[model samples]
Target: MKHPSVIIFFLLSYVCCFAQEHTNKEVDSLYKEDQFYAGITYNLLGKIPEDVSQSGFSLGFHLGFIKDMPINKNRNVAIGLGLGFSANSYNQNLLINKDDLGNTTYTVIEDTGTYTKNKFSSHLIELPIEFRWRTSTATDYNFWRIYTGFKLGYVLTHRTKYIGDLGKIRYSNIEDFNNFQYGLTLSAGYNTWNLFLYYALNPIFSSDARLNGSEIDMNAVKIGLIFYIL
Candidate 1:
């Protein structure tokens, strides 16, 4: 599979989760630690035509491990770095097409009965760096945390799926997608129920992508829940 990296990444996380178990005192004394994080997010296009707006739930997910380096004596403040995999899907009315001249275009598909489950998905391998704050002491299992970070991602795969008058159809390895993506992220909550936020800084598609002679500069935003395990 093209995404063997994702499987390998998760297997590493599963191993790390079991390899480390620390008492309260040990946790407090440790200058550095690592954690596994997983999250599910709702995704939406930041910019899109009104006629081509999202038609259904757009979901995304991420999983990975982060090495935390304590920056303060209290161990409540730290910096983190990690590698992860992320996948995002957007369900919308827009259809991707290539013109006779061989240029990619986004067109609004207005016939609802003619098309169902029009969605595009992309998978990425990402590196994340974050500033972390927590109220946990060595013994505390339930604590407040706020983590804000930046992520750089390289696309591994891109595909589109739809059910239409022609029948169920799928296309993979879209060529016009941007291969590199960078974004900002934030997660804040108490204990295990963290609210996650992600905003893409660059367009999902390359500048060559066009709709009606205008550039299609759509970006993605995600919001949802994140869970961290140590």
Candidate 2:
């Protein structure tokens, strides 16, 4: 599903719920404060970019999900709290920094490098509850849906191991999350299904081996489909 589609669904759901609220006064009055939703969501994890630019994506993969949420749908907004599990990895051998003190000297070493292959696998339990503002109750005129929210995730395991070329490779010792992860997400979509993209603004690792702050910067862009089975 695309980013825009997610927003459209949110808007459509919001409008439908609101309209129903007025006609079904008894149901609305007796309505439970929340709704329970569980479904499978597939995600594409792009290559961890080296620079601040999010434009380049050389490779990506799929992730699985299991979500359980208590939702509240109202006129202006609705909130969804979900728990999901995903497995994703990316590899690049050519960009491994090799000069030891390479960045400090500003000089290129003479064939003094090796292309290292490694993968970072994550086991994340995510809780993302988003709030959306609907412009209208009618889907025909409601072509816009805007959302902003936060997601809290705990890292169960983070592993980075080297592969290929037996004698020439050395492995890295990864640091675990200090405790938990807290980040923000923004998206827009339309049409009752999922037409939206999600952006994560958080570092994947809680600690870096370099001791500089974040050992690696993890910014992700995921576009997918979202709908309900039940």
Best by TM-score: 1
Query: For candidate 1, lDDT tens digit of each residue in 1-230?
Result: 23644564475456545434445455446644338887778898988756778877787878888998889988989999999888888998888755689655678888877887788899899999999999876666667899999999999989888788757756787777899999999999887578999999999988777777778888989999877877
Off by over 4 Å in 2: 1-76, 93-117, 135-144, 167-173, 176-179, 192-195, 211-230
Candidate 2 lDDT tens digits, 1-230:
13433544464465445533433233332122213222222333343333322212222222223232323343445555556543334343322222475321111112213323444444556776677554433222333556567767666655444444433433232343333555565555553343445555565544332223324444445555433211
After superposition, the stretches of candidate 1 with alpha carbons farther than 4 Å from their true spots are 1-28, 31-34, 99-103, 166-169
Clashes counted in candidate 1 amount to 0
State residue 99's C-alpha deviation in candidate 2, in Å: 17
RMSD of each: 3.8, 9.6
TM-score for each prediction?
A: 0.85, 0.49
